[model samples]
Target: MMGNRRPFKAAIIEFNPCLNNLNDNIKHLLKEVTEAAEKGAKLIVTPEMATTGYHYENRRALKPYIDTIPGKTTAAFEKVAKHYQTHIVIGMAEVDVEDGLYYNSAVLIGPDGYIGKYRKIHQWATENSWASWGDMGVPVYETEIGNISMIICMDASYFESARIAAVNGADILCFPTNSTGGSLSMLQAWAEMNGLYVLGANRSNTEKGYHMIGASTVWSPNGEKLAETSYIEEEKTRNETTIIYAEIDPAEYDNRSKRRLQSRQPDLYGDLMLHIGPWDFTKYELIKEAEDVQGNEMSNCAALLQYTPVIGDKKANLSKIKSLLKDTAAETKPKKGLLSLVVCPELSLTGPVHSLELTAIQQLGETDHDETVNEMQKLACMYQTHLVFGMIESDSHALYNTVMLLTPAGDIAAKARKLHVTESDERWATPGKDIVVTSTKGVGRVGLMVGYDAAFPETAGVMAVNHADFIIVPSCWHGDYGKEMALHTKMMENKYPTNTMTTWDAMARFAQAKTLIANFTGTKLGCRGGSAIYTLDPIYGGETPIVASSDKEEVLVVAIAQTEKDCWFDQNKLLLSRRTHYYRPLVKKFEHVPMLDCN
Candidate 1:
């Protein structure tokens, strides 16, 4: 309706479940669906485990609420759908009639009858106890309304689930979730990146001390939020329920999807299907060979420093970097003498400004031949270590948030501008054109990305395919650093957190390469540094991941031996296993798209 002719009206229901009471929940869902249909909603969606309720005491206790599809619950919903001529999607505890196994699943019903279902693939914390792992992968259903797919709760955390469905020709992704603030960022990301509408329905109210915060929402392929419920009210009271609706044209998404597929570099996504296996050393032995190399011969050691720069002070910022580098060299000279490389946060030279006025940020920017870069190059040569830093670059017409990599010889190796520009960045900087991986004399292939660029996997995939030994990310994250780290730790657990495309996930997803991420510290320019070094392969008999100070200036120096062997993938098999032709759907360029702000 907004831009296209034949619009499809879709509705999402957000309400409190009756808690293990299947009958009452079903009745409530049916009422909501009926109301949605009367209001002209062609398709309606409900929250995860809507029928049976979530937060079960035990798997055995959940048996009574679980039933097979086409059973009593589906039959009831089907009758209503048929009467209203509306499509319905709801989550339930599904039981396999033959094997007696249960699954956290979502069922789809149309006017005709039972359509299809999607079992939750990536189970959350408590789910693994009750529901068996999902057997069916991502499945898309075709009907008169549109090509629909479902991803429940934790499944939305996995970008691959949404990607696989989109690649299989899904126009709308219906997500039934029993989650909180953590995943809302990803919901809109999936929609805009895949060029499809996303309908997210989350449960509200408290269940057995476990609170479900509902912010049921919908987004267009262009990354615009069509409608969203109040997350604050949902968390406060059970009386607050939202049944929001939006009108979308499937043809718009179809055209966008075609453009998206045409722009993908599928040949570079070989690691998309790779399983880094596990962190347990049972499968592969640690390379003890690096230990025998002795003294200054260690080529793998690197340093990632957390620095805070004075805003708008280009001279002060350069002095701070020089001081940090000098201190690092002095401290490490007693050990391995010098680290192979050193990395700093984004906009290191100019500091960071969250404004676009040319006068405000332009004065801080300099040409590639500016004295700031030359000084950094001299430092790289002085320490005989590769130096990577972030700065604002001016090229006559535009200013850019750029990352520059300098060789140990004090010569420029490669420079890349940030491709994913933030709203604030657009006011002053232009986006980079492509993902570039530059080879170094001793560092193997090195890839450089700035700030938000790490949020997109395609950028990392391009670097990974180019055989980068490790990727350096210089970021100045703006948020509650304490909360972000806590959430990251809780969400990741001990499992190799590589299932999604977030900065932390990308580290594990591209485990073959050591990912060194550095950020600015303190609240000066609104950054609380949480620098980390991620390596799947253990170094020096300990887990390779380490987090620096949460809100203070710190340096994370770790020994990452340069290895010719693709330790995680077995001779670069991760890059070799990709089905290049099948990934055309992801070919479309999504870098320049600004991220949707979370409500």
Candidate 2:
């Protein structure tokens, strides 16, 4: 479709591209991509990893599967692309030279030749074993048809990934998916909220114990199910692939939304850098930081945290908290640490002092989403720090554990609901089931953190491993087994490549930042302590802390130099890396999680 108004002719190829069976996959892709293009689809989309099916268990096992464009897949597609004189967005398993690990990349080919490729920045399931994560952003390529950005299956789930693409002016978010039946509804809704035309092309078949529900479709800017692979229709013709044609126009996007870009506020989110690349030098300072008693000349960075009572009364608590923060802020103006931050423990505003706090809960307890969110923005701006705090989430239900990030510039960058609901957490909260990332010019991109979230190492580690500076964990610590030991295990197991580091100091030692675990100190219940500021090197193991304050409100400032993140090769040597060309890489894997309409 050209626009919601124009009835333009187009085709949607529900490509059942052979996974692992490259020769056949190409034979199929070449035929369909060309046929669809010739059938008058200015833009044609295919299923995820259409050229090569997703497959892989180990690096060595995957070596035989990987290949670059033009090797076999591209050579075949090039003819289709040129001869048809159309633009095509298709997925393939690629070998990045650095680590030798394969990448799920969607290469954009214009009629003239190959354009840039948008690598899948995110992955699913055992995908990490064979393919490393991609580093580039969701990019929209210009073509005669219109402006389009290609997004792989899972990548579309994250709001950050798509928002960035839209911010770059993508008229259509064309996704090549391989998903199960259950997830279809959610993806359709996503298209409507952003006023985007989502061309989600999913595959059908089984691989690595997973099978997809093939119903590729086109979603209009208003989210109308424009075209889907109708099983009934295909069955009649014995056709597996369905062609969905639609018209898209640049004007369908929300004009009001551009206000965010015209007034892009990067300054307020400066300290939010710890949200993305974890390896800033500042995060290391929090391990055991205290002002130079003798004025030993502190580092240029200040690691700051929210002030809380150390098991005391209101006045006594306020006095102590004020002194510590005031002193920290003055001593370290603009904070020595480049990554400035302040994390509020779950219920930081008022200690979990008593259950009565719940009665007063309506003020901003677990159930007060709107009010709490509003207050957080106010609190963050006043504090002049990149403030990320935890509080009880309130909705129709009693409560749910949740976290919110209030950028210093007074914007809400991102938020996360606790996925791992514990007894106490469940006592007042519902398990949060979504992932969000906020883009900031300062530290780059940061994300929200909730307590017990660290318990799902895969959830946290995968997010961190993919894209995130640091996770701002917000929760109250209880009786010591070292009660938080479970949290440590979760962190260790899910950290990355392999769960290598264990403790804050351990993470500090490994990743070069205490802030990675910088927020809290010695685990204690019935008392508030351990609030911190810090950074983690790109690798999860290298953690370090810059400045830390226990039970106090303070402005921990950071002055970080924008740094380049490490590529896959920096860690995995090619010989040991899993290159898809060398072996068969597993196609995408995952049963999509259910999420409410969080537009």
Candidate 3:
């Protein structure tokens, strides 16, 4: 407990089924959870499929017992949770209307009413015929007991599920299982690896006639086996009966629970739409280089993240920005009068690292403002080029990290702010919820996603579907880009040529691959440092931009061609061919207060 902590209590209930008897099943659960809370417990986690049991072998024969998430099963638990001033995470079957299928879902309810529902993503052997997977990815909930994440009977097998929960900072992870020994070991392994407390609620008996060994157990984040119901060890198939009881200190689970941002490389996911059309097989050739160019090939793009030190000498930083932009203008020179565009990073004028009171530069200071931009516009208008850059956008109580893009016509096209803020930025910034996209006159539809904005793969995916030909990410990061790069490289190694790879090469490769995601944002988070263009696959020379790691200011140039190859997501075969979840981080549980997040 920390200064003035709200100490919440939790218990694990032993569930045994009386085949299809909902009345008796309800009576037993109410008795067990009520007794636990009467002793001051605030939450009680129940066993998996305890109400109807896991006897799906005859499910089609007994459709009468089936129900929806908001039906009787959920209604019963809702009343119980509220009456006790406690919370309950209950497992039940749901007929998902989205896909017209039944799914094993866990519902959480506070004293008030329903909290949220987590439909099981993974299913057991015969479960496929009975249910459909939940497409929300993962549903993590906050409760009076603690910030919790649930994995149904079979969901815990995948390492990514637990990794995601730990990565997002879960304190108490509740697992409601309807399994025996082999499955029990798997749950224990997950809890130890994640370094989060877990409650294992296994049914004593199932309607399917399988006898549960009923070794209801609990484990700390570290793999240490802590408590289990006192029972005679027996074969998993043997039927047994026992009630597990233990007093757990929620604060103990809070140890080793710290979260921070490293590099989140979200671009590798293939879910985003990056082309003007979804693989219409249009007229464009794969340009291996300038020599391989066709009439329809568009020039590569230059996406820049401008930077100035928060407290350093302003004159020097601004001068550096000017020199960098000048070089960038020279590099994106388009052939035959059609220029490549420049999309700049957010807060390039005044540093994004400081408070509004310190770094808010309202104007570019006369000569520094329109004078420099006029020069940029003249170059764009002269060389027939474009640029989307950033400036200090401020008004009253706020300042924004904006992207300023100039077309060949030499005018501002689009602007947006960083949508999310971590602890490091909460003291200084506000949130931008929606994304911004602009249709550049000749360049097609282009979108903007700030640094933190890219961490969520959906941001890019949504833009891609809406008509974005390309996306710009101008970022600044102090997190680990090495491990993520290595991970992504290993995943895509066999699928694509290694080309040039040191740790730096892999970092750049993963960043672009993640962003160019055909259907899902590839591992949506930043995995490398530096800034550059993301050319979708089949455009030739691979998918990433120039790998930039040095603190020194520089400009990167990429020529994006208008190709006939469709965006990956629309082409299921293409998406299936590549390992989209490339380079995922996996780690053992650290057991300490600050747990390991596969970093």
Best by lDDT: 1
Model 1 lDDT per residue over 185-227, tens place:
4666567666778898887687776666666779786556788
Stretches of candidate 2 off by over 4 Å are 1-8, 97-99, 181-186, 231-239, 250-272, 276-599
In terms of lDDT, model 3 sits at 0.51
lDDT of 2 by residue, 329-414 (tens): 66665535323455556554445533544455544454433544665566556656565665556667556566666667767666
Name the best candidate (by TM-score).
1
Of candidates 3 and 2, the better by TM-score? 3
Q: TM-score for each prediction? A: 0.60, 0.46, 0.46
Residue 176's lDDT in candidate 3? 81
Task: TM-score for candidate 1, please give it.
Answer: 0.60
Which residue window of length 10 is worst by lDDT in model 3? 516-525
Please count the clashing residue pairs in each candidate, in the order shown. Answer: 5, 97, 47
